[model samples]
Target: MLDVLVVGGGYVGLSAAVAIMQAAPHLAIEVIEAAPEEAWKKDPRASAIIAAATKMLDVFGLWDRIEPDAQPITRMIVTDSKTSDPVRPVFLTFDGAVEDGRPFAHMIPNVSMVAALRDACAERGITIHHGLRATGFRDTGPSAELTLSDGRVMASRLVVACDGVRSKLRDLAGIKTVTWQYGQSGIVTTVEHERPHEGVAEEHFLPAGPFAILPLKGNRSSLVWTERTEDADRLVASDDLLFEAELERRFGHKLGTIRATPDRRAFPLGLTLARAFIAPRLALAGDAAHGIHPISGQGLNLGFKDVAALAETVVEADRLGLDIGSVNVLERYQIWRRFDTFRMGVTTDVLNRLFSNDVTPIRVLRDFGLGVVDRIPGLKNYFIREAAGSSGQNRPRLLGGQSI
Candidate 1:
């Protein structure tokens, strides 16, 4: 029997496996991925990794490998306007530096981050089985048994599900969730610009939704353009010329001529929060636990936070000779993360509802709120630290750059 069995071999699952194995090598850990091998290479997405997550990666010895491909967000600008408006007046500006002159976040290609994580798993001798899915999950007091698509059953003292929001394992384990669709989809794509962005990230709140332009390496930027689901699909399926024209309407000429790459895709936005984070020998992580909007860019960071908290809980329990998967042991992780996850989910949902509209009174209220926050140095600093993931109390060891 393995010590830990991870379902869904994405970044979160792989990170969970690596975190535990590195701290407690005597424990056996393995990952099962539904996708075929090398499928992760085709992903054209990028994520904003906060400073705390980078510290955790640094502890894993993968940050040095990932940093070269990352573009630091030296500053962030927030604006509110309509798509037809010729100008978008900036409402809030944030200097990205947090503590010790470290930028609050960096825009990193998904490929680069996952590549380094996979390399770390290889060095740690962690076996990752691809092209396999978990069909069923059973907890038999002593261990959890997961049935794979090939009819093979694997038993482990603990089972961690890092599957996405629509996790089969979560259903099989009988975990319920609070979920609601926003009727919006985020259109993601990469764009090459004529002028440099100078490491500035911008979020423009238009009538449809918030459109973000995140700086990337060289003269490129990654865009997260949110719109109604139907409209997003139409835009994605539109011709290059038409799409670029529409993109330009929102993107403006700040970065000069912009050409979007062809690999654009749209993802439906929603909030999914598992009511329970653990059940017997099974624990949920990543999207299995919570999936929030991209308005704050904290989706992946929340998953990384889970990795850190879950790893510490399991490692410490093992060091004390306790059953790592017992409800008592896993409950620590739940207590540590559940409230924070709920708070963020509510925050994003409220923000999305508050800004994704054209109500004049509401717009005036929100913009005034933003302006107030911007003018207060102490409040702005507090928010920056919060976004950087370094302001919370009782943070996990890895997030603090310490070994478990």
Candidate 2:
């Protein structure tokens, strides 16, 4: 019997396994992934890893491998304007460190981050079964039995679901969710430019949604360009010339002849917050627990936070000779994360609704608010720290690079 069975071998699942192994290596850990072997190699998108998340990776011995491919966000500028505006004046600018001279976040290629985590898991002797889908699971008092799509059953003391926003395991566990779709979609793609970005990130709040230009390792930038769902579908399916023309309209000439990289994709935006983070001997992590808009680029960081908290909670429980999967034990992890997740979900929902529109009065108010925030250095620094994942009263052990 496996001590821990994690469904979904994405970054969050792998991180959860790694954290458990780091804290309690004696316990057996295995991850079941629905995708075929090496499928993660094809993810072309990049993610913003906040300072706290980076430290967690460092503790896991994966940051060194990831840092080489990461582009630090040394500065961030936020602007509000119409998509057709010829000029966009920056309303808020944050430039500096979160702590110890480290930038608040770093843009890391998804493939690089996954590869690092995979290598670390390999080093730790963690088993990952690819092409295995968790069809269902049930609590059997002391342990849970998981059913695979191939008619096989595996027993484990606990099951952690990181299967993503549409988690089948979560449904099988009978956990409910609060979900709503935004009428927008985020068009993600990489762009090669003649000019360097100088490690600066920009968020242009256009009428449709926020268009973010995040610096990459080279003379390139990753774009999280948002648009109405219908418009996004058309733009993504358009010819290269047409797409580039539309892209350049908002991208401007500042990047000096920008062209979209071949890796282009669009993801529908939505908010899906799990009503309960835990069920019996089961726990939820990553997208299985919550999904928020990309307006703040905190989706992955939120998952990392889950990884840290759940791992710490389990390890501490085990250290005290308690059943790691007991409702009482699992509730600790849920309590630590539920409110935080709810808070962020609401924050993103409100921000998306507030910014993804053309309401004149609301725009005026928001822009004025941004301007005021820009002038206040203390408040700006506070927000920077918050984005860095350093604002909470209690910092998790893994988040601070400390072992449980």
Candidate 3:
């Protein structure tokens, strides 16, 4: 019998397994993933790894490997404008470092992160079964008996659902969620530019949604271009030249000549909040627990936070000879994470609704608010620290670069 079984071998699930083994090496762990091996490496997108998340990677002994490929965000600028505006004035500009030397965030390629996590998990002797899915799971008091799609069963003290926003395991566990679509889609792609970005990130809040330009390691940038669903589909379906033309109108000539790279993909935007973070003999992590708008760029970091909290909870419980999967034990993890998750979900929802529109008065109010925040150094620094994940209490040891 496995001590722990994690469904969905994405970064979150892989990290969860690694965290548990690192803290409690005697425990057996296995991750079941529906996708074949190496399929995740094809993801072309990049993610903004916040400072706290980097600390977790450092704890996992993967940061040293990831840092070389990570592009530190040294500065950030936010602007509000119409898609057709002749000029967009920056309403807020932020220094990307929370401290004197450390950057608040880094833009890391998805493939690099996934590879590092996978390698570390392999070194830790955690097993990952590829092209396998958890069809269902039943609590058997002492353990959860998980049914695979192939009809095989595995018993583990706990089962973690990291199967993403549409988690089938979460459904099978009968956990309900609060979800709604945003009517928008985020078009993710990379673009090569004539000039270097010098480690600056830019967010242009157009009428449709926020268009973000995140610096990459080289003279390239990753674009998270959001638009209304219908328009986003047409733009993505258009020819390369047409796409580049549309991209340039908003991208401007700031980075000199820019051309979009291949593998242009669009992901629909939405919010999904699991009503309960835990069930009997089961726990939820990553998108299985909550999914929020990308306006704050905190989706992946939120998952890392979950990995930290839940790993610590389970490890501590096991050390005390408590059943790690019992409702009593899982409640500690739930109480630690649920409020933070709810707060972030509401924050992103409000921000998206406020920014992704053309309401004149609201735009004026928000732009003014941005300007106020920009001028107040104390307030700006507070926000920078918040984004760095330094202000919260009871943060898991791993999140602060300490082992459990």
Would you list the C-alpha lDDT of every candidate in the order shown? 0.95, 0.93, 0.93
| Pairs of residues clashing in candidate 1 | none
Ten contiguous residues with the weakest lDDT in model 2:
395-404
lDDT of 2 by residue, 117-146 (tens): 888889889989999898878999999999
User: Model 2 off-target regions past 4 Å?
Assistant: none
- How far off is residue 404 in model 3, in Å? 0.7
Error of 2 at 144 (Å): 0.5
The list of candidate 3 runs beyond 4 A from truth reads none
TM-score computed on alpha carbons, candidate 3? 0.99
Looking at model 1, which ten-residue stretch has the lowest summed lDDT?
Answer: 81-90
Clashing pairs in 3: none
- TM-scores for all predictions: 0.99, 0.99, 0.99
**Model 3 per-residue lDDT tens digits across residues 1-404:** 88899998888999999999999999999999999997997888889999988888888889999999999999999999998899899999999887546899999998999999899888989888988888878998899999998899999999999999999999999999999999999999999999999999999999999999999999999999999999999999999999999999999998899989978988999999999999999999999999998999999889999999999999999999999999999999999999999999999999999999999999999999999999999999999988888777788999888999
RMSD in Å for model 3: 0.9
Residue-level lDDT of model 1, residues 82-112, one tens digit each, is 9998878899999989987899999999999
